[model samples]
Target: MEIRHNELIQMYPIGYVHNIFKEAIFDEKMYSSVSHIVLKEEFQDGLKDITDFSKIYVLFYFDRSEGYNLIQKRRYDGKIAGVFASRSPRRPNSIGLTLVELLEVKGNMLTVRGLDAIDGTPVLDIKPFIENDMAGDDLRSA
Candidate 1:
């Protein structure tokens, strides 16, 4: 029960991600292939029509991770987690969510694919992962 530091936590990078995941460590068997994201040129008109949703929820900005260790150690087993239940990019606020799978948008760039982020990375927002809310079928359908 401790979260009170307001500046309302703002964000602005509407676009800047192009990946092949150049490298940031974490290739323990290529974690789900499919990769490509561009999104730039004046925000590419926000990629209108979002390709009728195939799946997308990028929200990036780990900006090359910097600090945090509120309890870590869970590569999948050494359990000592609790940095918000471990998705650990070593965070005190590095912000990096990924659910990519738009596949193509061409025009300012957006061909995303299962992003794990880390290749220019700065796409602070891009939602559209709603598929029946009210607790029915979300969690990306599962």
Candidate 2:
């Protein structure tokens, strides 16, 4: 299939992140803090058996991130790198992904830790973190 560069894709948020931090904070403290992923009432049934996994991947949208820099200095090392090489919120598509520890699941709310996303961040999806899953292996190796 030929992919169109100008094609647009639409997605509805399954939930939103809730935390103490109101703004983006690029620091260790932000990732270490606890956060909540509150799913919509209609999506509540999807949370069933989610607690079986200790860790999960939180895919969210950076709604507040306005623009992107194809090439920029790394936040931590200060070395230059491409946008795709670093975890900068500024990207062609302002999408953020973080692996957070699943602490608890109560009703439609999920208590998690190590989530760097700020409060009210729209959560795109959630997936279990399977360490042994080879699905993440390099495509060249396939």
What are the clash counts of all predictions, listed in order?
A: 0, 0
Which digits, one per residue and each the tens of the lDDT, describe model 2 over residues 1-142? 9978888899999999999989876667877789999999999999889987899999999998989999999887888999999999999989999999999999999999999998899999998877666666733342
Worst 10 residues of 1 by lDDT: 28-37
TM-score of 2: 0.91
**Using Cα atoms with residue i matched to residue i, what is each candidate's TM-score against the true structure?**
0.32, 0.91
Q: How does residue 116 of candidate 1 score in lDDT? A: 79
lDDT of each: 0.75, 0.90
lDDT of 1 by residue, 1-142 (tens): 8868654777788777765677667764334666556665778887788898998888787887789888888777879988878887778878878776787887877776668776787888888776665576565463
- Lowest summed-lDDT stretch of 10 residues in model 2? 133-142
Deviating ranges (above 4 Å) for candidate 1: 1-6, 12-32, 38-41, 45-69, 74-87, 97-105, 110-122, 125-142
